[model samples]
Target chain A: MAIATDARPQRTTTVPRRKRVRRTKGQKAFAVFNYAMFAIFALICAYPFYYLIINSVSANNLSALGDVRFWPIGFHLSNYGQVFQLQGLTLATAVSVARTVLGTAGTVLVSAFLGFMFTQERMWGRAFWYRFTVITMYFSAGLIPVFLIIKGLGLTNNFWVYVIPYLVQPFNIILVKTFVESMPRSLQEAAEIDGANILQVFFRVYLPNMTPILATVAIFSAVAQWNMFQDTLIYITDQSLYTLQYLLYMFINQANSLATAAQNAAGGSLSSIASAATSQTSTSIQMTVAVVVVLPIIFIYPLFQRFFVKGIMLGAVKG
Target chain B: MTTQAVLQEAASSNLVREQENTLKRGSRKRVGGKPNGKKSIGMFLCILPFLVLIFVFSYLPLYGWIFSLYDYQPALGLQGSAFVGFQWFEMLVSSPTQMAQILQVLANTLAMSFLGIATSILPLIFAVFLNEVKAPWFRNIVQTLTTLPNFISWVLVYMIAFSLFSSSGLVNSVLTDSGIITTPVKFLDSGDHVWITMLLWSLWKGLGWGAIIYLAAITGIDPALYESARIDGAGRFQLMRFITIPQLMPTYVVLLMLSVANLLNNGMDQYYVFQNAFNMQHIQVLDLYVYNVGLTGNNLSLATAIGMLKSLISVILLLTVNLIAKRARGTSII
Candidate 1:
């Protein structure tokens, strides 16, 4: 239904030519200025990542970094090697990957299932249950209580803390419910006519047809799980349970403290201070860790970009 | 009638037929509802686990808010602890130091959130301009690259900031080596213009992602309006100014009002990572302050009391915004 309205807008292509014909020299200059501004804005948006990648593989010394402007200076892979060799990097990466996959999959399944259930006409107490979950979207018990509850449940220092608390995200449930409601009712009725049970109709009929919205919500859940660090900070005290983001956070803090220490020791002998700073984690290693954390999302983003845009559009239009 | 109007009429009629069919089917189901007891049980069973999870995770925490009334201790537990009868609430208002801290935290939260709302229009402008980009591949690349940062963790963003803004980092080193300044400028922890700095960081992370919704809104606008405006001698800028901006106004206003309602909900991730000894005084927003007071300081009752107040204010804000939206637009998000 939304696509029909959206498609109506693109049918009137005669406007472009008419608008172009009316453009004067000053208007043309304005167009050029618009392009220039966007170009600069795009550069500003993209340069940090570019700088990160360049510095990550660049030689890990102050002298090598001094003249570096747009690209690597004396490029080497030593920083990445150092990043990989950092204690707990592999374990943290594993934990991150596992949580993202499991948490996203579990959340998508449960949210979609509940969403499907809520849209049923004959479901018992549908209004009450729907409102019960949806109201949590506006008001929550606040942080301390939620933390105490999670602690009370003994999820602290547990991996399930990442997955279980987020398994039934009410916002995603609403998104899925909206998507399912927009689907033609005949799809479900036809499956019912074919002797499919509710579960079969849901799994075989609705789930397949829900790929676009499901993919969108999956990307959302995946991003949330991957980027989460606050839960680890609040719930997990053990170093072994730290996700990659938290590990990188710790590394950044460690590096900052090292720098601060070096600054404070600046009044000491130059030779001792220089050696102490050199022994600390280099700027290149920190950037390399950042590149490591960010690269997966960059690699996977394009694959899901189309559905992602559609999902956002669907949400905005519905709202 | 115009073709578009005819199509819309046909769509609405079809929807009416669908609704009628569903109503008839619903009546049939109501007549046979008692006989479908087994099936209803199965369906209820399917949703039972989710209901349990919600009750446990979401509703249970609301009950846990009673911890604020008691001097909560882990060993004694809420049951064992003495009920102080609004002592924490009393302390929040009566204690001068606590009142000062609350005021500061509230200021930081409102400042950051208002700054965020003020800059929200940038995304609309960005979407308008980005829609005008003629090259598909270039626009796509820029959009993809820009939105990619929104998915990145704040921890990584802080790392990026460290690389650029640290004392021995690239920006400072380059400036010093070129004789721009003798002493390195502390960008990260200087606590100067922290509001603007955080706002800029937020814009960098979210501007493109935020623009996606406006761009979507733009796509929904009927092109025939543009066609008519252009044939009447509207230039590109004129078309955008008169047609596009006005079309996008409702969405902009709704979003702006919603952000105002969410003034206290600045998540602690970015500020948490960026915060240190030097900048904590300035950067600790309400959410982070709650976390610090509760977990870091081990003052659970005080944290819970402050958190309860924040939540109450947020609920009020949400209801007020929803009421305004309903009065103005005849729709509430709820």
Candidate 2:
């Protein structure tokens, strides 16, 4: 439906174009100025990541001294090694990865299913169910109540707890519904004429047409799950079940141990090295942990970026 | 016409009408079928997973609020817990020490959230400006850059703030080296600066992602509107002010309502990352207060009570705003 509205204006504009209007000299200069401003803004945004990545790889003293190095002063994997050396890094990383994958898959599946059901022409009480889901989207049961509920269920430290609670996201359901609602009713009419049942029409016919929106929802859910830190922080009491973000939290809070550890870990006096190793005063280790936690998001960003662009247009074009 | 032929035509027409009626009735019945017997079983099966989640995590725990009336202890394990109805609330609300702390935390949270919104509004405007440019590639690149920060976790954000603004960090180093100031400012640890820095950190994280929706709405405005305005001698500023802003109002209203509804949600994780004892007074929010009392302080009942109060108030506020929007402007958020 949203796409139809968006296409409506473009459809009218595609007639043979009028001759280009002559631009004033000021307009040409202003366009150049706009281009320059945009380029500078882009550079400022990208520079921080460049700086962070370069600094994360630097050797001990360089990391602590906060040198303005655009390139790595002394590159080594030891910082990453130090990050993984944190008590529960491996388990936490694994748990977070598993939860995110399953959680995204589960949320997309349920939301898509509900969306399809809501769009069914013959589905009874469709409006009631639609309004119920919308209310849930807008009115949460509150965080404390949610936490209390999690505790009462004995899922405080349980593995299934993480994915189960967020298996269905209401906002995603609404977005998918909007997409399905806008689909041509003629398609469903054709399927009915061919003796297709409602379930068959939905699964075999409509779902295939829903690929783009499904991809959009999948990406949104996955990104949200990947960045989920708050729930795990509150509910997961056991340190072993910590997610990547929580592990990073531990490192950030323990910043005093971070500075000298980086310096000595790179190379230092025996006493300093002993103090760094035993005292664990290395910032490099925390930097390493930060790097590990952030790497996946950085790499896969461009792929998801496309879907986000498409998704943003879907909502507004309708209204 | 033969009498037999006329009779045959009438019979066939009647048969066609009967089939149409049956099909219509069948669809209506299926759509409105009651959930009972075999159909009830199917409905239950269809909704089993959602039910399990809602029961285990939402409904059951609502019953668990009974503990808030007790001095809950792990040794007592809820059953053996001592009942202390309104005692914790009294201690919190009546006592000067706890009451003052709570008020301060509330004040801090409000200031942080308000300041964060004020600071981010400019970036949103900038995003609108960027959207007006006809260069697609440039717009995409700029947008990607701004949104990249949003994806970085709060932990990384904290690290960046410390590295840039710490006493020994870049900002202070430049200040001292350039003789702009004789001493390095304590950007992270100073009590007065914490709220401001906290808001800045949030703005930095959310600037790009926040603006994306507004920009999308802006782009949705018909290009013909701009053409009309241009023909009418409307300059860019006038066009934006009169046409674009008005068109974007509904989207803005919805976004504003969401932001206001989420006012109490100060994002405990970001503040938690940035907090130190030195600036604790300035940085504490209601959510943080609950975390301290409930999780770290191990005063489970008190924490739950506080959380319950906050949630109730926030929900009330949300509903009130939503109702006002619906009644006054005909824009219902739900």
Q: Find the candidate with the highest DockQ and give its number.
A: 1
C-alpha lDDT of all candidate models, in order: 0.76, 0.66
Complex DockQ, candidate 1: 0.40
lDDT of 2 at B124: 43
Question: How many clashes in candidate 1?
Answer: 0
- How far residue A124's Cα lies from its native spot in candidate 1, in Å, is 0.4
TM-score per candidate, chains pooled: 0.89, 0.82
What lDDT tens digits, residue by residue, belong to model 2 across residues A1-319? 1111120123245444435567678778867887787677667667667766776777656666566447887665555655554557788889879988998888887877777776553444555555555445434444555776677668898887778888766566666776776687778778878998666777788788988988988876776777778877788888878888877777666676645444455353544444322333345566567667777887877767877666655554322
lDDT (C-alpha) at residue A33 in model 1: 82
Candidate with maximal TM-score: 1
Per-residue error (Å), model 2, residue A285: 2.3
Q: In model 2, which residue pairs have backbone atoms overlapping below 3 Å?
A: A1-A182, A60-A262, A257-A281, A257-A282, A258-A282, A258-A283, A259-A283, A261-A281, A261-A282
> How much lDDT does candidate 1 score?
0.76
lDDT of 2: 0.66
Model 1 stretches astray by more than 4 angstroms = A1-22, A63-67, A256-280, B1-39
